[model samples]
Target: MNGTPIRLRELAPDGGGQLSKAEQIAQLRAQLAELDGGAAQEQIGGEGVVPLGGELANVLPNGGLPRRQVTQVSDTPSLIVEILRQVTEAGGYVGVVGWPELSYAELSAQALRRTVAVPEPGLDAVHAAGVLAEGLDVVVLHARSEIQFTPAQARPLLARVRAGGAAMLCVNVAVPSPALRMSADIARFHGIGRGRGCIAGIDLEVSAHAKGWKRPPALLTLGSATGGVTRLKAVPS
Candidate 1:
């Protein structure tokens, strides 16, 4: 995808000469497969894994997020930001779709520069994500409440992710056979002892479940103390 240009076309039908929504999506996937040049089927070991940082590495089975797979995140905005930031910092391109609430300012300058954002794709969120995954290292898609995809609708999109060797992070959408499932909850706040000072850091209880295996919960700290960065630590069992 280095020399190839990414042009996003409208999903609407253009008079009598236009392709239907389904046809347009099919065309996008076909184009992606051609642009992929069979790279997705090639296995290069570590090169295929996105750097999930040391702390996160400890919890994941692959020691990082694996390319050509879809991972589901349970709508943890901060965690999502951290994941995208890490991917971008590693010189990978990222696409964010349907997350109009996500603030780009929260991302590092480097991440912000490398990210492609599609804040609101209306009902075409899934279609937009598939197209972005064709060329990006990672794509974060926020599932729309009104649009629930059946298994039939997900297969082609997931195929696109695999065909391009890109990871898809689905927020609050349960797709079939996700490689990993992660959820985060705020456990407590630090540096606010007795309510005497502003919150300097936050402790989050994060869990990772891979297929039939479930790892012990991990503790992640995020806030001003760490310069608003995420620091993950495995809590002792």
Candidate 2:
């Protein structure tokens, strides 16, 4: 991802008339397809992958998060922050929507400078994400509880991500379909003190499986104070 921003041109309706939401989505999809030379498949390898850092990189088929695709993060929300941290730390811009609770102070100054945040993303969350995807290396979206999208509502957003060569990190929301899915089977905090002991770290058993991969689960230990993740040795089966 270059430091330069890519701005998406908004399409206007015919005859100066307004377009319905569905129609607008369709138009966006068409524009995106045209931008990619009407071949979405070509975008599969167009942009370089973003490294997840540590052993987590090994979980994905590409050894990193693939641009131009939606990757779902379920069960362990912290993983989302971890990803954003990695991307920003690497000089990649990131945009986050509908996640006001996130602790931005934990992020490094360099990373924070490259990150954009939308505290209250409303009904146009998908639209906002599509716009952000135009330039950012990664866009993290937290679907609002009241927002339920039909297949039609999602297809265009996915297409936009592909065309723009940006990765979408969906939190608690399903895309049309995800190219890769990461789930945590277990997450526990350790180092509890009797009176004033602080949380030492967290232990997670995360599994990564794509459309046709058959890899084993990955064990991770995350330190709360340092924001560091360590891959534990796999136990014998």
Candidate 3:
């Protein structure tokens, strides 16, 4: 709580000393937010929103990712990559914890470099996120299916996220409250030559919901040719 940044090394794995370490990091983030007068929370665009870009933007009530809040995402690798790419391309720093399965091949070189990744945080996933949130714009925590996300564990991390002015993306993790809950599935694949040619693109059915509102499901495409995301036109019903 001395207003000093918590280094990655200071993180303690879950054990007798885990809770105290988590608390320390949380306090540091709170102090940092206070020192900055919550400037990050007061960002101008859409009242501190992080634009996800393209048609995906329209899917959110705020037209983008909510800053200083938590959003739960399904364990869809492509969709997660898209979110990270957009955030980093927009000049936001990102931290990813406990997602060793995520592929960065689609991410731009610059974006990949700007990301701080902890493939395995053991039992300190939340603590690692808090430390990274102190300076990163977004912290993604991939909760292992075996590990439960209890409210006791989530409250402090959620507080750290708000105080640090960073967005938290929980994959396969359930916390008490989240600004948005999102999930996506592959609708179909394009350009397959009877199992002869490689897949060229995929159509994704994305759903986003919030406390008081929900956007109509969206169809998006990730094409190998363009290696980018775009809103796919809905076919006439």
Candidate 4:
């Protein structure tokens, strides 16, 4: 049900010097909605990650981070690091879903405007989706929250994006809608091994998942922006 209507009389005490039954219900609904983050999630898809459109073109295969759904990455929070950076840099507010799982302060460097951390991570993903739908540029769900699959939950967001009407970005750590898949434009996944005292090398793997992106995912070693990301290797489909 939608949030309970808050009527005028509820704002005051009754003859008994206490809120009436209806008022009590209203207050309860109000609190519940606030706690739930404002809305409910709709269901849509199934598992297996696929790339989305080219938004992060320079960083991933589909040229874009997965939109309207959860994006699962294996290591280093590489996808989140770059995608959120891109989102905030483009002038947007970013929300972190799983607070404990991320080094938020270190990540805040990416936000151009402001970053709002969700106070509680205990809410289910459907509830989380409701809160996200209210208003947010980006919401990153780490491996903390309880997420589920519902068709209506994700479809509207996709519709909003396709219509260019919604200015929100939502991320999940669990599975996503089966109809929804994101292609990487130029995503970089980097791993480096070194002794506790010595610096070895950073291995960077890049992928292009766009339909027009003929280039395969590449793996390279790094040095710096100019000289790093060297030794590109294509990934065979």
lDDT of 4 by residue, 54-158 (tens): 322433533444444444443345445554554555554445544444443323443523344443333243334344434444555554434554666656534
CA lDDT of every candidate: 0.70, 0.65, 0.70, 0.40
Of 1 and 4, the candidate ahead on lDDT is 1
TM-scores vs. true structure, each candidate: 0.77, 0.73, 0.77, 0.47
lDDT of each residue in 47-115, candidate 1, tens digit only:
567767756777777767778788888787878877777777776667777776775545666566566
Which 10 successive residues of model 2 have the least lDDT summed? Answer: 1-10
Please list the residue runs of candidate 1 whose C-alpha ends up more than 4 Å from where it truly belongs after superposition: 1-47, 144-148, 227-229
Q: Comparing candidate 1 with candidate 4, which one achieves the higher TM-score?
A: 1
Ranking by TM-score: 3, 1, 2, 4
Worst 10 residues of 1 by lDDT: 1-10
For all candidates, the clash counts are 0, 0, 0, 41
Of 3 and 4, the candidate ranking higher by lDDT: 3
The 10-residue segment of model 3 with minimum total lDDT is: 1-10
C-alpha displacement of 68 in model 2, angstroms? 1.0
Write model 3 residue lDDT over 1-237, tens digit each, in one string: 123231222344567756465565564355434423432343324437777776677778677778788899888888888788887777666778887666777767667655666676655677778776766667788866845568887788888888865778888778877889988999888777775878888888877899887667777788774565455443322
lDDT (C-alpha) at residue 169 in model 4: 34
